[model samples]
Target: MFGWVSGFFTYETTKSVVVKSWSVGIINRVAQLLIIIYFVGWVFIHEKAYQVRDTGIESAVMTKVKGFGFLNDNLMDVADYVMPTQGASVFCIITAMVITANQTQSKCHEMDQKFKCKNDSDCESLTFSNLASGKITGKCIAEAQRCEILGWCPAENDIPIEHSMTEVEGFTIFIKNSIRFPLFNVTRGNIGENLKTLSCTYDPVNNPDCPIFRVSDILMYAGEDFSNISKKGGEIGINIAWVCNLDEHVDNCKPTYKFTRMDSAFKNSVVTKGYNFRFAKYFKSEDGNDYRTLHKAYAIRFDILVSGNAGKFHLIPTVINVVAACTSVGLATVLCDIILLNFLKGAKQYKAKKFEEVSDSVSRSQSLDLHECSQKTIKREEKSSDDSGAYSIGHQV
Candidate 1:
């Protein structure tokens, strides 16, 4: 109980220092140097360890495409080829189209290759599947041996049409982008000047600042051909990246753009062939009858994707990184101590000098008391022996 009470209040501490060796010193110095390099080179210079980061970005984009071509021997303008006419941030221009003109609400004609039947039971009063163009009426056109669907009178032609817009090679798209870092209170725009962007084109080596890009150039950058992709539509992606260091001047912050083709090339397979969609334009005849023209438009889709991150100096991160670097330095001392006490020559001697057993005041007092008790017991035994011998001699006399 006494020993436990003393131990509860007392603690052991070592006070010896080992004579340092060249090998140990070298190892420690190397460890310290590595820590210093990591803190200064990587954390401070490269990663900006003193700064906090904010990636929240606010962005807006405006895009416009310009081109001209000949469609079916008719001169076409940008207004004729571009969808929605007014243009949007994301838009497409038709490179190929299948036009079905002058149609009214009537029975849809069936293709000879798709629908085949022998009698009315095979073609009449049949519910069409979801993939069917329209609902079938209870009438079979025996000549075609197919069901009639109550839809646009004349069915759209499925004949293959190969139209190419090679003239669109020189077509250019103007992209205007503005980005803001709310945390750092910094904002940047791709266009430095209105006239500069209007006249220049995006060229990595020569005119990188220009926001105007040629469609053909973009296709080429993505390892695609304009002539080949024009026949069958595809998707193109435009990526704008902004990495800003708030410590520098705001003007230095600029965006870099990348182009990639999102869709695979044509593989001559019907399932994964190309991208196309159908739209209709309705017109009223002089007799007040409704007529429409259906157009299957195939065009390259452009998707503009924006992303960014911004960073600025802060005291909290700096302090945290500094503390981590200092802690790593202490690890070097611990490692060297392990090597000296366990691996080096004369390690046992060094261990004995380095570590010493310690005792509390209570333990010392208890040890002294035990020694005194043992000495008193030995003296009592010797005196009893002498008394026994004297008593025996007296009795004999």
Candidate 2:
């Protein structure tokens, strides 16, 4: 009875030890998972976003920390391992929902068009003749379909922005030619990545008297991957500047121009590429000093660049070899096909000639036999008639 009691106690002790070990193992796993989740969500995703923002256009970036989606595929390693618990899954879902809602609001605001220009003639309203002195004030009565005022510039007649008009003529021509080009069909949401045209107005904020020139149909490509871009992709910067040339236009003054870059700064506005320099104020061209015109107009362009090192060596070498080999094979095939076609045509002509010769020989033989038979019939008829006439005379005697 004592032995039995001891055995019962030992079994209970073993069971408790087993339960404690299992509980410890589970806790360790959960802690490890949580740590991994926090690290990846806080570090890698934010780092990538910051890098994207350093570039000069507005950008909406969405990174998934939860279930599988486009960008979440990249995060699957950590997310799947950590999200097994009900609490973790719920947390990730909440985070994704908040991000998505913010994206919708941002997108809705961006899609709201804010600028209007009735027609191309409205572009002429951007002349310096319409600017107000001291307090910049001007207006062009030109009508436009729609226009959004992004920013304005102010310039002093005495202190002109430097080098703003150096490439005025060329820049003007580019603007005119750009009109001939088609408007960029920017996608409205996260479905596709593209740059949308934003209206830029250059009127002095302090003084409302300035001629506002409108840049229409500016071309810009987004620098974000499709999965990373938000439904409301982001805003494009419309940089503008008011630059005056003091030297060439002013009597007895050294040639110089005052220039300033202007644009609206918004959240998610920075992308991987630098901001557009179209509206940037800089001295351009040292020669040919007509600095007073202030006829320069500018636009922005955005380009996205993607860099990765996976399969670098194998991919490049394989592609190079494939292209070289394909070109060679294609050229050889084309040449061989041409040669074969020509040979086949020659052979057919040779066969046709042989057939024509045989036909000609048979026709000639048939014609010769027909002529000989006709001649023999004619001679036989003549001889029979003569013999009959001679027999009749002998009978009469």
Candidate 3:
């Protein structure tokens, strides 16, 4: 029990071994220097370990388009071509339209050629045929070989007229975007602060602060042909990036612009070709009946996307990273110990010096034997002195 208690209370400490060779010293110092450089140059300065970052950005965007074009013998303005003319961020510029005029509520034949059949029984093979002008009447009229429908007389032709609003290439777009970082309480906009954005067109090298962009230039930046996209209508993206280092001047945190073709993958799709939607304009006839003109508009859509990260100096991050850097420097000792113990020429000597052991059992046994030997030697000396004094007295008598 005593031995167990003594063993349990034993103290252990680290052994320091100073190696005084050129190779080992050089290796140790070089390892420490490299560790210091890595933390200072990469972890602290380049990565900005001393700052706190916010990526949750709140943003608002508004856009406007301005241009005029002559299409199908009609003068078209922004009010005519721009869908949802309220200047929203995501808007479409119509390039082509299939107009079906004077559609009244009556029975009509489907315009789709796939619905054409010889008899009513032939159209019966298509059970769920809703692609007609309206609800199917379940009869194939002999006059028209297509299936009969019960609404909108004189069915709309699915064929679009070959009218491309090529003049849209010259149109200009103005974008106003505002972004905020809630953590830092900073708000910024893409347009110039002096309000000169209205008169200037955007050029990467000349007028980067302007929010205006030309249609052709946007397509050029996205590597798309304006004429091809205007014919069938496709989606384009306008990306605004606001990467800010809040430690610097606020003026230096202006937004950067990028263009992308969003619908490039489905450009050649046969089933879902391009971007189009249908809407109708109603009119009241003199006979008190309602009639309408349906328009299927093919348009180029633009989506404005905003993204950003803002970083600023903070005391918590600075202190935490500084402590981490200091703690990380101690790794050099481990690296040097590994090289010295396993790979160096005098590895045995270094390994021996770096480790030491003290056993209590061996020390206790040696001390007990030494104490017993001194006691016996003292007894023998006293006995010899007594004998010598007795023999001298007898000889003198």
What would the TM-scores of all predictions be?
Answer: 0.76, 0.15, 0.79
Quote the lDDT for 173 in model 2. 7
- By TM-score rank, best first, the candidates go 3, 1, 2
Which of the numbered candidates is closest to the native, going by highest lDDT? 3
lDDT of 3 by residue, 1-397 (tens): 9989988898787765556666666777888898889889998889888989999999999998999997777889999999988898899999888889999999878889888978999777764766767888778988889888888877889895577888999999999999999999999988767764387888888888889999999999999897788778899999999999999998888999999989888989998877888999999999999999998888999999999999899999999988988888788888878877798777777766666667878779888877878877868888777443221111111
- After TM-score superposition, the amount by which residue 13's alpha carbon in candidate 3 deviates from its true location, in angstroms, is 5.0
Clash totals, every prediction: 0, 35, 0
TM-score leader: 3
TM-score pick, better of 1 and 2: 1
Q: Who is ahead in lDDT, 2 or 3? A: 3
- Candidate 1 Cα outliers beyond 4 Å, as residue runs: 1-32, 116-126, 138-140, 193-197, 264-270, 331-397
* Tens digits of lDDT, candidate 1, 17-48: 54546777788889889888988999889999
lDDT against true structure, model 3: 0.85
Candidate 2 lDDT? 0.26
What C-alpha lDDT, on a 0 to 100 scale, does residue 182 get in candidate 2? 12
